[model samples]
Target: MPAEQKSGAARALAELSDFSMKIARGQRMLDRVKDEHVQIATADKEIVFREDKTTLYRYKSTAERKVSVPVLVAYGQIGRYTMTDLQEDRSMLRNLLALGVDVYAVDWGSPSRSDRWLKFEDYVDVYLNDCIEFICREHGIEAINLLGICEGGVFSLCYAALNPERVKNLILTITPVDFHQDQAEGRVNHGLLNLWTRGMSDDDVDRLIEASGNLPGELTGYVFSQMTPGATLSKYNVGLLDTFDDEKKLLNFLRMEKWLADRPHHPGEAAKQLLINLYKNNEMIRGEFQLGERTVDLSDISMPVLNVYAKDDHIIPPKTTQALRDAVGTSDYQEIGLEGGHVGVFVSGKSQGVLAKGIVEWLSERDAPSARD
Candidate 1:
C-alpha cells in the first residue's frame, strides 16, 4: 500500500481501538453500578415541621454550632431543595453544616392537581410563616436567618418585606428581583425565561393554567432544556460518554440527572401569578406584587441583606438579581458574585465552599449579640 493509504489505515485502527476500549469500560461500569451509587440529597436530617405538601427538615451535623440563630433554607417550588444537598462531597447544605451553621431546609413536596388553587400567599404567608414561627418557638429566639434560593428567594423577599421583624438577616441566592432587567440591560444571552414569559399574554397564561390545572414539571423541564438546546444535547451525549469510564464522575452525572428529573409542578394560581404578575407586569419591583392582602414592598425589608448571585446565571440573569441592591431598604446590603451558572453555584466544586463560606461569614457578622438584639 502507498504511504498515504498506510497512514489512513493506522488512523482507522487507532479510532477502532479507542471505541472498543470505551465500550468495554462502559460495560464494566454498567455492571458494577447500582441505584444506591447515584443516590442524591444523602445528608441526614429529621423532619422539624410539616404542613400540607411542605416539610421543614433540620440537618443533623456534628460540627460545632457557631451561629446562635438558625437558618431556614427555602428553595423555589420549581425545583426540590435536594439540589443544595446533592451529594456528600458536593453539598452546600453539608458545607454550611460543616462550618457550624444551624441549617434547616424546606422541601416543597410534589404538588398534585388538588394543589392547583394554591398561590404564593399559601407558600409565603402560610407555609413559610409557619416554619419560621416554629423555628423561633423552638430556638426561643425572636427571629432567625433566612436563606432563599431561586424562586424561594422571591418568597423570602416577600416574607422579609411583609414581616421584617421576623427575619433577622436575609440571604438571597440566584433570585430574580427585577424581572424586566434583561430587556433593560440588553443582554441577549441572559433572562431567556423572562423574555419568554413576557412574550406570553395574560389570556395565554390563564389559558395555560386552566388547561393544565397546574404547570407540569415535565413541561417546565422541556422549556429549560430548550434554553440551551446544544448544551442539553451535549450533556447526554458527549457528557455521558466522557463519564462512562470513571465511576465517580459517572455517579456525579447521575446524581444531577436525578435532581433535574425531579422538578415539581408549580401550583396553577401561583404559576399564573409568577408568569403574569411578576414576569410580564413587573409587579414585584413596582411594589405591586401581592401575596394575600399585602403587597410585597421590597423597601420594607429592613434586615441586613446578603444578596448572592451567579455571575454566569442565564435563567435569573445577574442584573436581575443585582437589582435587589437598590430596591432593598437596608443600608448594609452586600452582594457576592459567585463563579458559575444557575445550578453550578451549588454543584460546582469551586463554588460550593465559596458560597457556604460567604453565607457563614455574612450570617456570623449580623448574628453577633449587638446585631441580634
Candidate 2:
C-alpha cells in the first residue's frame, strides 16, 4: 500500500476503536444518567407580581446597565417558561441580560384539577394585563416592550390590540396566528398542527377538554414525539448510546429531554377555545377571537413589530408566521427567517447566537425616547 493510503487506513481504524470504546463506556453510564439532575432558569430574578398560579419575574440586570424600558417575555402556557433558560451557558434569558436588556418573564405555574374552568379570557385579559400594568407602573413608564413566544405570542398580540397604549414594541417568535392559511402554499413543509386540527370538529374539541378537564401534558408530548417517530425512538435507544461519551453533547441533549418530558397540562377552557375558536374557525386573523366582551383585532397593534419564525419549523411553519405582515396595523413590522427547526432556533448554540444578536440589534435601534413616550 502507498504511504498516504496506510496513514488514512490507520486514522480510520483509530476512529472506529474510539467509537467502540465510547459506546461501551456510555452503556455503563446509562443507569447513572437517571440520577443526574441539571438545574435550569438559574438567572437572578425577583417576583414583581403574582396572582394565584401566575407569577411575573423581573431578571436583575447582569450587564453594566440596561435599556430605559424593560421587555416582558411571555412564553406559551402549554409548557414551562424554563425552555428559554435551558442551562447556565445556553440561556437566551442570560444572554439578553448580558446585552443590557431589562427582562421580565411570566410563569403560568402548573394548574390543578380545580383550575379546569380557567378560560383564555382569564389568561389574556386578566393575568396578562395584570402583569403588563405592573411592569409599566414599576418602571414608571407609559409603555414597555413585549416579547411573546408560541401561545404566549397570541396573548401578546391580543394584549397589544386591546391596550395599544401600553405596548411600544411587539416581538413574536414561533407564534401560529393565521390557522386557516392553505397548508401546501408558501411552506417549506406543511405544518403538522394545521393537518391535525383541520379534521377536528367543535364536538371533538369539546369532548377532549370536557372529559379530561385539562388537556393532559403526556398526550401533548406523545403527539410531538409522533411528529418524528423514528427520531424519537432513536433518542432513547441508539442516539444516546452514540453520544454518551461526549459529556457536553450528552448533557445538553439530556437537558432538552428533561424539558420536553416536563410538559404542563393545558387549561381546559383555553384548550377548548384554542381548538374550536382559533384552530378550527381561524378567528384570530378574522377579528373573531374574543377576550371578555371584545374581538381581538390584530390591526389594533400599531407599534413597532418584530416577527421571527424558523424556515424549517414543522410546528408553526414559516408561512403561518410570515402572514403577520399583511394583517398587522404597524407599518414598522419586520420579519426574520432563521435557518433551522422550531425549538432548535432557540436552544441550539449556533442559532441562539443568531437569534440573540438579531433581537439585540432590532430592539436597540428602536430604543429611543420616543419609543417609550
Candidate 3:
C-alpha cells in the first residue's frame, strides 16, 4: 500500500476504536442505572385522604408555604401520578415545593376486577370532590388551587364547571381539551390516539370493557407506546447507546423507563365513556358530554385558568390544549407555549424551570388576600 493510504487507514481505525470505547462506556453506565433502580416521588408526603383505590397525598414542604390555597394535582388514570416526580432533581412537585407552593397529588391506584363499575361520575363527583373538600376544610378555605393533567384535565374541567365555587384557579398542563382537533383539516400536528380512537365503534368499546372489566394498564401502555412506535422500538437500545457515557442522563432515562412501566388500569366505565363519547364523538369539546345527569359545559369553568402545553408534543397536540383559552368562560385565562415533548413538560431540565417559573408567577399574581381570609 502507498504510505499516504496506510496513514489514512490507521486514522480510520483510531476513529472506529474511539466510538467502540464510547459504546462500552455507555453499556456500563446503563448497567449501573438499571442496578440502582432509583425510587421516584422521593419527596416526603402524608396521605391526607383515602377512598378505595384513590389516595390524596400532600407533600411535606421544605420552604414556607407562600400560597394560601394549596395546589391539588389530579393526574390521569392511565399512568402513575409519580410521573410528575420521576426524580428528585427532575421532579415537578419538588420544584413546586421549592417555590413555597403547597403541593398535593391524588394516586389513582391500580384497579382490581371489583372496580369495574367505576365511572366518570364516581371519579369526578365522588373521589375528586372528596379530596377537594378535604383540602378546603383543612386549609379553612372555601376554594383551593386545582392542577389537572391530561385526562384528569377533563375531570377538572367538569369539576370546575359543576362546582366552580370550590376551585380558585385552575391549571391545566398538557391537557387535551379539544379531542376533535386531530380530525380537523389543516392540522399539521396530531397524535395517533385520535386516529386510533376515531375508528373504535360503540359495540367494540362496550364488548372490550365487558370482557376485561377495566382497561388493563398494559393495554393502555401499549396504546401510548404506539403513539410513537418508532421511538418505542428504538428507545431502550438507542437511548441508552446515546446517553450511556453520561451517568446523570442515563440514570434519569432509567427513572423515566420505570415510570412508563408503571401503568395503572383505568376503570371500565370511564374507559368506555372516554373512548365512545370523548374520543370518538368528541363530545367534550362540543358541549354535549354528560357525567351522570348533568352536562359538562366548558363555559361553566369560570375560574382564572392557566393553560400550559408543549410545542412539540406528539401525544397531545398544541391545538388540543390551546382550545381551552377561548372555550372557557374566564377572561383571566393565561397560556404559555414551551418547547418540549409531552413528558418533557415535567422532566426536561431546561423546560422544568420555564414551566415552574411560569406557574409560580401566574399563581402568585392571582393568590388574592381575600382568598387567604
Candidate 4:
C-alpha cells in the first residue's frame, strides 16, 4: 500500500477501536447500573409539615447553625425541587447545609385532575403560610428567610408582600417579575414562554384549562424542549455520546435526565392565572395581580430582598428578573447575576458555588441583629 492509503487505514482502525471501547463502556454501564444507583435528591431530611399535596422538609445537618434564621426553599409547581439537590456534590441544599445555614424546602407534590381548582391563592396564602408558621414555631423565631426559585419566587413575593413581618430576608432566583419584559432591551431569544403566552387570548387560556383540567407536565416539557430544539436533539446524540465512555459524567447526565422527566402538572386555575393574569396581562409588575381577594402588589414586599438571576437565562430574561428592583418596597434590595442559564444556575459546577456563597453571605448579613435594626 502507498503511504496515504496506510495512513487512511490506520485512522479507520483508530475510529473502530474508539467505537468498540464506547460499546464496551455502555455495556458495563447497563450491566452494573440499577435504579437505586441513579438516585437524586438523596440528602437526609425529615418532613416537618404536610398538606393535601404540599410537604415541607427540614434537612439534617452536622454543621453548627451560623445564621439564626433558617431558609425555606420554595420551587414552583412547573418543576420539582430535586434540581436544588440533584446529586451529592452538586446540591445547592447540601452546600447551604455545609455552610451552617439551616435549610428547609417545600415539595409541591404532584397535582392531579382533582387539583384543577387549586389557585395561586391556595399556594401562597394557605399552604405557604402554614409552612412559614411551622418553621417559625419550630425555631421560636418571628421570621425565617425565604428563598424562592422560579414560579415559587412569585409565590414568595406574594407571601412576603402579604406578610412581610414573617419573612426576614427574601431571595428570588430565576423568578420573573415583569412578565412582559421579555421583549425589553430587544432580546429576542429569551422568554419564548412569555411570547407564547401573550399570543393567546383569555378565552384561549380558559379553553385550554377547561379542556385539559390542568397544564400537563408533558406538554410543558415539550414546549421547553422546543425552545432549544437543537440542544434537545444533540442531548441524546452528541451529548450522550460524549459521556458514554465516562462512568461519572454519564451518571451525572442520567441523574439530570431523571430530574427533567419529573416535571409536575400545574393546577388549572393557577395555570390560568400564570398564563393570562401574569404572562399576558403582566399583572405582577403592574401591581394588579390578585391572589384570592387581595392583589399581589410587589411593593408590599418590604423585607431585605436578594434577587438572583441567571445572566444568560432565556426563559426568564435578566431584564424580567431585574424588574423586581424597581417594583419591590425594600430599599436594601440587591441583585446577583450568576453566569449560566435558567437551570444551569442550580446544576452547573461553575455557577453553583457562586450561588451558594452569595446566598450564605447575604442571609448572614441581614440575619444579624444590628443589620436587621
Candidate 5:
C-alpha cells in the first residue's frame, strides 16, 4: 500500500472506534435503566370498588381515622395516575396512604369506536358524579375530599362547584384556572391553544379517537414536543448522555420515559369541550361553564380549599392558578408556591420536601371538625 493511503486508513479506524465506544455507552445506560423498575406496589388494603366505563381503585388506610374522609384521585384523561406513584419512595400515593387517608383513584380506561359518541357531559354527569356517589355510598358518608392533579384538578374544581354539598374539602395541585394568561413569557396559554385546537370539530376529534382505540402516544408526544421546540430536544439529549453511567439516574430517566409514553386518548367530546370552554373561552374562570345539569359557580364551594402551584411552572402559570382564592367562597383557603416546573412540582427533590410537606400539613389542619358546624 502507498504510505499516504496507509496513514488515511489508520485515521479512519480510530474514528470508527470512537463512534463504537459512544454507542456502547448509550446501550449500557439503557441496560441499567431497565434493571431499576421502581415498582410502586401499594401496601394499603386495596380493592376495585367499581369497574364499568371507568375503573375506580379504592385504597383504604388501616390506621383509625379521626376523620374518615375519602380522597378521589382525579388526573388527566391523557395519562395514568401512576405518575403520582412513579417510584416507590417518591410516590405521592404512598405518602398520602401513610398519612392515613382513604384513597380512590379514577382510571379512565381506553375508549373504543363505540365510545367515540360519548360526550364531555357524559364524563362530568355520568362517570365522575357516579364515582362520587359510589364512594359516598360505600362509606355511608355524606361527602368525600377531592384531590385533583393537573386536568383532574380542573375536573375536581368543577365537580366541587357543581356539587358543593358532596365535597368535604378540595385539594388542587398545579391546576390552571385562568386560561387567558400570556404565553409569550414561557407560560402555556391553554386558552389560545384551545381556541386553535377546538377548530377541529367534535366529530373530527372523534374520528381520530375511533381510528385508534386509545389515541396514539406518538401523536400526543408530537403535540407536546411542538409546544416547546428546542428545550425538549436538548433535555432528552442531556438525559440520555449525561446519566448514561449512573444506575439510579438512568432508572429515574427510564421511569419518566415510560410515564411520558403511557398516554391514553382524551374522550372526543370531552377533549373538544376542554379546548373550547376551559382552554379557548376560559369559561371555568368566567363562571360560564356548566357541569352536567349543574351550573358551576366556583363561589359555591364552601369547603376548605388548598391550592398549590409551582413557582417556575411554564405550563400553568402562577397567575393562572392564583385567581382561585378570589373565585372560591371558602374563607379557609390557602395557596402554596413550590419550587419547580409543572412536572417537577411533584417529582423533583426540592418540591418533594416543600410542596409535599405543605400539602400534608394543610390536609391535617382541615382534618379537624369545627365545633360551630
Candidate 6:
C-alpha cells in the first residue's frame, strides 16, 4: 500500500472512533440531567424540620450505641448541605448517622433581598449561637459536637472561640484558617471585591439582592470556575465520563454537579466583609479579627479540636488548613491528612473509609464519658 493512502485510512478510523465516543458522552449527559430533575422533585423527603427561616435535616440511623452525641453540621453558605447527603451510599450524613450519631444539619435557606445587609457578625454571634443553644436545649445537653465545613468551619472556629463551653467537640474539615493568597488557588481578589463594592451604595446592593432574590447559583459557580480554569473543565469531564455507566454512580455525580453549580449569591455586605477580612486582610486567623462586639482569637478556643485537611485541595490549600494546628489554643488537637482534593474528601471512595471513619472515631473519643469526666 502507498504511504499516503495508508495514512489517510488511519486518520479516518480515528475520526470514526471519536465520533462514537461523542455520541456516548451526549447520551450520558442527558441521563444525568434527567436524574437531577427527579432529585429536585423529591427534595422534600430529605428535609426533617423547617422553621421561619431555617431548614434542618435529620439523618436517621439504626445503629445501637451506649452514648449518643448530638452533632450540628455547619456547611458553607455558598452551597447547600445536600452535598453531604449526595447519595444514600456515599452520603456523609448517612455515614455519620450509621455510626450511631444523632446528626442535625443546618440549612440557612435561600437568602432574600432583605438579607443582603446581613454580616458575618450576624452569622457568628446570632445564628450559630442560637443554633447551638437550640440543639442543646432540645436534646437536654449542655454542649454538643460541632462539625464545620469550609466557611462553616471558619464560623465554627469563631463560635468555639466565643463560646467554648457550648462546644463539646470541634471537627473542622477542609477548613481554611490561614487566608494567605500565595498558598491558595481560586482565592477571591480583595481588590476585585473592593472594586466591585466601592461604587455600589446600599440601594445598589439592595437592588442587586432584590433583582436576584438570593444570588443565583450561576454567578457563584462562575467565580469558583475562575479559581482553577483547566482543572474545573478537565476534572469534571473526566468524572462525568468515569461515572457514565452505573445509574447509582450517575445519580451521585449529578447531585454533586447540581450542588457545585448551584452557588448562592452571598449577601453583598457580608461577602464584602469576608473578602476584606479573610481574603484581603487575613484577619480571622491572625487573632485581630472582630465579629460584632466579640473578638476571634484562636487562642481562646480551648476545647478538643479535630482538624482534617485534604492533601490535594487547591481552593483551600493544606498549608492553609494546617495552620489551625498552631493557631488554636486547644491542647487536645489532632490533624489528619486525607488523600483527596476538596470535593474528593467527601465524594471519593478513598475518603469513605479513612476520612469518614476518622470523623466517627474522633468524635467518639472526644465524647467518651471518661474524656469528659
How large is the C-alpha RMSD of every model relative to the true structure?
1.6, 3.7, 2.1, 2.0, 4.8, 4.6
Question: Each model's TM-score?
Answer: 0.97, 0.91, 0.94, 0.96, 0.82, 0.82
Quote the positional error of residue 31 for candidate 1 in Å.
2.8
> lDDT by residue for model 6 over 37-71, one digit each (tens)?
52531222246556546676655555765236688
Per-residue lDDT tens digits of candidate 4, residues 1-373?
9999999999999999998899788778868889998899999999989999899999998599888788999999999999999999899999999989999999999999999999999999999999999988877778889999999999999999989989989999999999988978787788899999999999998898888799999989999999998999899878988887788898899999999999899999999999998999989899899887898778888899999999889899999999999988889999999988999999998976788899999988877522222
Q: How far is candidate 6 from the true structure (C-alpha RMSD, Å)?
A: 4.6
Give the least accurate 10-residue stretch of model 6, judged by summed lDDT. 36-45
- Would you list the C-alpha lDDT of every candidate in the order shown? 0.90, 0.84, 0.86, 0.91, 0.73, 0.73
Instruction: Evaluate residue 235 in candidate 6 and report its C-alpha lDDT on the 0 to 100 scale.
Output: 65
Model 6 TM-score relative to the real fold: 0.82
What is the per-residue lDDT of model 3 for residues 36-85, given as tens digits with 9 covering 90 to 100?
46788888999989999899999999798777678999998877789888
Query: What is candidate 5's lDDT per residue for 1-373, written digit by digit as tens?
Result: 9999999999999989876786688787665544336453344545565545688888666555534577888887766787887776667776677666777888777765556556656766678889988888777777888889988888888888878888888999988887765353454433334334546665665566557653565677777766666767887776566666566776777777777877776765576567667776788889988765667789988999999888877667787788888999999998888887778877775655565456667777777432212
Clashing pairs in 2: none
What would the TM-score be for candidate 3 when compared with the true structure? Answer: 0.94
Which rank order by lDDT, best down to worst? 4, 1, 3, 2, 5, 6
Better lDDT candidate (2, 5): 2
User: Which prediction has more favorable TM-score, 1 or 4?
Assistant: 1
Superposed by TM-score, candidate 5 places the C-alpha of residue 282 at a distance from the truth, in angstroms, of 1.5
Residue-by-residue lDDT tens digits, candidate 1, 91-202: 9999999999888999889999999999999999999999999998888788889999999999999999999999999999999999989756676777899889999889
For model 2, the superposed segments whose C-alpha errors exceed 4 Å read: 1-20, 28-37, 186-189, 369-373
Model 1 worst lDDT window (10 residues) = 364-373
Report the C-alpha lDDT of model 2 over 1-373, residue by residue, as the tens digit.
Answer: 9999999999999999988888788766655565345666778999988999999999988887546678899998677889999988788888889888989999999987778988888988899889988987776788888999999999899899998988889999999888866374666345766778778887888888888799988988988888777888888768777667676677777888889989999999888888788888889988888987888999998999999998788888777788889998989989999988878888888776788778888988888533334
Which has the better TM-score: candidate 4, or candidate 5?
4
